[model samples]
Target: MYDRPYPGNLYIHEILNGHDVRAYNYFRMPAQVFTGLRDLLADRGVLRDTRFM
Candidate 1:
């Protein structure tokens, strides 16, 4: 998300941190892949039996 430093950076810096700061962006890349896997698990009804549901 460093490459997408438009609204994302602004939002994190201005709203989240209240100033310029370095922080991890949990919105793209590996996060997206993990979210996709979670969605897939939900679609397969696997998470229905787990606390993740």
Candidate 2:
């Protein structure tokens, strides 16, 4: 995945040239929310390994 900065937000993409992307209002996002999502993804095998940065 990769991130790109915009005027007042950021976008994260799961693929470089595909449609799997999401826009983040980063300044308003809570860290726990991200962690929870990561954990869910790992549990469901959506992520290859249970690893996150």
Instruction: Give per-candidate clash totals.
Output: 0, 0
RMSD of 1: 11.2
Report the C-alpha lDDT of model 2 over 1-53, residue by residue, as the tens digit.
23344321223322222332232343244455565787799899896642332
- Please give, for residues 1-53, the per-residue lDDT of candidate 1 as tens digits: 35655654354434334322222243334444555776899899886543322
Reference-based TM-score, model 2: 0.39
Q: What shift in Å separates residue 35 of candidate 2 from its native position after superposition?
A: 0.2
Best by TM-score: 2
Q: Candidate 1: where is the Cα deviation over 4 Å? A: 1-29, 49-53
RMSD, candidate 2, Å: 10.5
